[model samples]
Target: MHRTDGTRSLAGLLALWGATRLVLLLAVFKVYVFPGPDVTSDVLVIYQGWYEVLRTGTFPLDDVTWQYPPAAALPILSPALLSFLDYAHAFFVLALVADLAVLALLLGTGTRPGRTVRGARVWVAGVPLLGPTVYARYDVMVTAVAVAALIAGTRRPRLMGALAGFGALLKVWPALLLIGAVRRRAWAAAAVTAGVLTTLFALAMPGAFAFLTFQRDRGTEVESLGALVFHVARHFGWDGQVLLNYGSVEFLGPYVDAVSTGALALTGIAFGWLLLWRMTATRFLPHTLADAAFVAVLMFTTTSRVISPQYMVWLVGLAAVCLCFRRTGMRVPAALVLSASCVTMLEFPLWFSHVVASDPLGVTLLFVRNGLLVLATLVAARRLWRTTVARPRPGTPRGSAGEREGASHADADPQGLPDAADPPGLPDADPRGGPLSGARRGLTSRASRGAG
Candidate 1:
């Protein structure tokens, strides 16, 4: 009966995914026009132009907007694999394939004995919320790699590291997926993979590393958390121009540097907090890896100077990975991210003109979306810290919810489990049929005596 239910659930998930994805494909393919500005222009114009340049055995050295890492060339150039199709059509098809690949990875990991299908559900639902922009950006492909790495988790640390490294090269954000990896092997593997790939790209391509210099003059993007200050200031006669800077709309004028620098400082602080969490955290559940990664990415994303609409995909992917484990504390944060993705779609392709104009409707959308992200980041960080770093009270008894979670998954601990000498409520203890587990037996005995 359980298996039947599971099969039905899986079938339903697949059906929903197919329906939503067909809508996305139709939108991107121009069969059904999506609202707002044409999101496909990035792929049709910019990505295709870069593809032409990358195919000639060199990076886009002259293009200041070419600010991504060297491995970004692979996706830009991937459309050539479908040589029969035009560039934009082929890119959309590949994007859809990447989206399917992510769903498959989630299903493969989220259906195990201790896992849940909520992760697959999150992926199915979250992607469509961002609308067709999810398919137009190469970020979806990078997200696929990141999802695979998180699913690998502690069971396959080296594979996780390698994929994370490669994903970082693709977009630079996937490197945060390693924040919860306690294994030395994972770090070593990531360093080696990144080093080898960096060297190879540097040696083979004429301007493989030139992207480093392209972002030095970037301004605060209109959609970012810090951009709210400028958005309102614009109404009060602030002399700032919202121009297409470094391929995205940004505020370029006085005090823009200050806001951008503040964003960078916030990012630095986020890094500091993550490092402290890693050093102090002791509870290591199977889900901690994904939970920590989700938190880390949220911190960086929320504090970023450029919160592009597609950036929501990274959060959604990581959040889905966290929810795969039934015990993860990231459910609330994941919900917030999903909500933010919906709002992001509204602010972007739906009503982007208002946003760029700093109109009331646009300001409200940015506030709601950025506010959701900020709340999710804080809530996730607190939950992660409480679960892993904060210890129980001095005289607390065993078998508390947090303690049981850690004990049940103690096998996932990178360091060995606690010995008998450890404290009763310490996360590392063996419970051995504690009070909570024996409640049913106690209830049965009382009922039997009453009947007699």
Candidate 2:
């Protein structure tokens, strides 16, 4: 009966994914027109232009809008693999392939014993909520690499680090995926892989590192959290202009720099808080890696100066990984992110003109979307801190200190249940900050050995 139910759920998930992805493909392919703007224009024009330049063995040195990392050239040039199709069509096809790859990985991992298929559901639902924009951008491809890295991190630390390192070079945000990693092998492998790639790219491509200076004067994008200030200010005759700056719709007049600075400061504060969490954290459960990665990415994304619609893809992928471990407490934040993605689609390729004009509809969408992201970040951060930080309460019973110390790990199994059913007469973790032993140690070893 259990196997039959699981098979039915899998069938439903696949059907939904296929149906939604078919709609996305049709919209991007222009068989059906999506509202507001042509999201596929970027792929047809900007990405294709970059591909032409990259094929000549150099970066787009003259394009200020080419503000991505050096390794971004791979995805732009990836269309050559599908030589039969035009650049735009090939790019969309590759993007769809990457999307399918993520689903396959999530399904392979989420169906294991003690794990649940909730993560796959999150991905299947969240991607479509953002509309066809998911396939028109290379963020989906980058997200696939990050997801694979996180899944590999459970039992293959070296592989996780290597993938994370490669992913960071593709886009900068994947570097945060390693924030929760406890094994030293993951960090070391990441460093070596990144170092080698950096050297290789610098030697192989001219202006490979030029992207570092591309965003020196970027403003707060209209879709970002900081842009809310300008959107409201526009109604009061603040004399600000919304312009296409650095490839995004941004506020570029009175006091724009101030808000941008504030966003940067918030990002700094977020990093400091993450550092504190890492240093003070004690419990290292199987889900902690994914949980920490999800929290770290959420914090940075919410506080960024530019919150593009595609940024939500990264969050969805990470949230899926977090949910793969049924014991994870990130369900609320994942739901919040899903809600934010829907609003993002409306603000982007749907009602984008209103956003640029700072009209009521656009302003309301931005507020709700950014507010959801902020709430999700705070909730996720709090959960991560509470579960990992060792907080001994005052006047606690001395006899129960051992139990309290290991309470955080009690419900970290793949089934989201307490590990109290471990083999009898075996002890849990040591109360004095020593190593785990007995059945508890065996359970952790087993959990750590799996892909959960």
lDDT values, one for every candidate: 0.86, 0.86
Q: Each model's RMSD to truth, in Å?
A: 6.5, 4.2
Q: What TM value does model 1 have?
A: 0.89
**Candidate 2, lDDT over the whole model:** 0.86
Error in Å for residue 332 of model 1: 0.5
**Runs in model 2 with CA error above 4 Å?**
393-452
- lDDT for model 1: 0.86
Assess the local accuracy of residue 376 in candidate 2 as a C-alpha lDDT between 0 and 100.
99
Model 2 Cα lDDT, one tens digit per residue, 34-120:
998999989989999999899999999999999888889999999999999999999999999999999999998887665677999
Point out where model 1 deviates above 4 Å: 392-452
Model 2 worst lDDT window (10 residues): 411-420
Tens digits of per-residue lDDT for model 1, 1-452 = 98899899999999999999999999999999999999999998999999999989999999999999999999999998999999999999999999999999999887764577799999999999999999999999999999999888667889999999999999999999989887878888899999999999999999988888987767799999999999999999999899998999999889999999999999999999999888666566678889999999999999999999999999999999888877789999999999999999999999999999999999999999999999999999999988776464456554466555544344353432212222224333233312223444354345435433
